[model samples]
Target: MNAYSGHTYKFTKEDNTFSYIKVHIKTQIGVKNLTRQEAVKLAGEDPDYLVDDLFNAIENGNYPVWNVFVQVMSPEQAEKYKWNIFDMTKVWPHKDFPLRQIGRLTLNRNPQNYFTDIEQAAFSPSTMVPGWAPSADPMLQARMFSYPDAARYRLGVNYQQLPTNRASVPVYCPFERDGFMNFSDNYGADPNYVGSTLLPTTFKTTKQGRTFSTLTEHEKWAGEVSSFTTEIGHQDFEQAAGLWAVLGRDPGHQDRFIGNIADHLSSVTYPRLRVMVYELFSRVNKDLGARIQTATEALIA
Candidate 1:
């Protein structure tokens, strides 16, 4: 599967200056997708088809590779951009923000143990190396907290102590000790309290003034002050309309997309709700909404 960093992030330097970036990982072998009919057949016949294929590919030495690229947007550009940089639903057009090749990722090996390596794995967007930090994306901010909290609930409080979840570099947090499945020496008699004189702990040092960049006045004014609400407007459908135009360029792709959506919408029993769905899509494109409604109603009948 192709991987995308939907949430924008920051790449900071020792001077505390930063640039906003988003990552794209494209398969080196090129993208190949199964048709809806083939996908359905495989789902029923071999539920673990994808996992099996990936495992076998690596095991047989034909490792899957992905070319990694990053799209950078300066803080100044973000402030003046027409679209909100923090909106995960939107993307930076390649013409404006070109992709810069950063690196390659290769799935060279399989998991040694399913339980230890695969089952116990816990990942969070908040888990970042130095010089990397999160942006003001609302959904990303929520996920950063919720993901780790979920891991704590599902994998126990000391989930980070697990082999798969443990950081490669040293982490010095004595306060976070003696929880469920804590296998470490619990800091080995080190003082858990900060600014302890009895037992001193050395922390990894960074350059002075290398703090995460502060939000601009515009960002500060726009973020996190209102109660949550579900509302829709014409502006929201602008991106959807753009996507429809993109699909139109791909010949039968638009037809397949409509058919796929109709197959799912046909199962909706509520007549009013189905109408609402169609109306919402109508905001995207009139023709698209009409086609979907006709196809869905035909299937339901």
Candidate 2:
């Protein structure tokens, strides 16, 4: 997820001059893994096992926590950064930009009602507040619009009116007058469209090039800040190489990554798909490519 925000994010000090940053969250207990065999068995026999484990832990006052840390890169550094910071698959190497401890995240409370609180809950990327904004990552930008559009369609236009989705503070809206299932007095007949003389709206000064007014400035900011999709380059593999090295630090992780990928590749059955997968991985690294090909062939055979 931190890979999605690789742009040099802003950091302000006492004097107000700022630098850019990226954040990483390392769980205190470290990452846990399940073997392919174990995962398959669990999925068939106990699909909710993981959820039960989390709930039981919190109920017993054993909260799982993650140490949040950030990597700082100045605007000057970002301008001259080797790889495009907007790419989601790439990470800012920790050696170049070190982690600075910021805070901790704890899963303390479970939802009271799964349907009302969890199932129906809307998690829009546009939900972000000020000081914390979205970067130019294309995937992130897409999610900002896509997630809420899904929620509004799935949960109705007044989905935000749900007890779980409702804002804690008084949410004032002059434009959202009515919809299919509106319940908020329809904004007392204020024109849903602009040019209303009764309740004059105050529009914020937005980033240049945006034409959509219904969306918040933050949503517009996300689109303006990102890079367009284009051709791939060697730099894409650089961070993957570093990640492969990190995966090697753990026993059997590198093997598992290969075997796991091979297991899926075997399911493809098509010779062309297998060849494409092999070629792609080979481009990532020669050893990974060869191993994946070997493992995949063995599985298929």
So what's the TM-score on candidate 2? 0.80
Per-residue CA lDDT of candidate 2, range 174-284, in tens? 655566767766667556676647654566322343322333223344445455557777766777877888889978999999999998889996799889989888877
- Once fitted onto the true fold, the runs of candidate 1 whose alpha carbons sit more than 4 angstroms away are 196-231
Model 1's alpha-carbon lDDT is 0.84
lDDT, residue 192, model 2: 64
Clash totals in order: 0, 3
Q: Largest lDDT belongs to which candidate?
A: 1
Question: What value does the lDDT take at residue 270 in candidate 2?
Answer: 74
lDDT of 2: 0.72
Q: Which segments of candidate 2 are over 4 A away from where they belong?
A: 1-21, 185-201, 204-230
**1-301 per-residue lDDT for model 1 (tens digits):** 7899999888877556778899999998887788899999999999999999999999999999999999999878987887778887789988899999999999998999999999989999988877787787888889999999999999999999888999888877777888767888898966667674665544433446344443333456337431333676787788889899999997898899999999999999999999998998888999999999999999999
lDDT of each: 0.84, 0.72
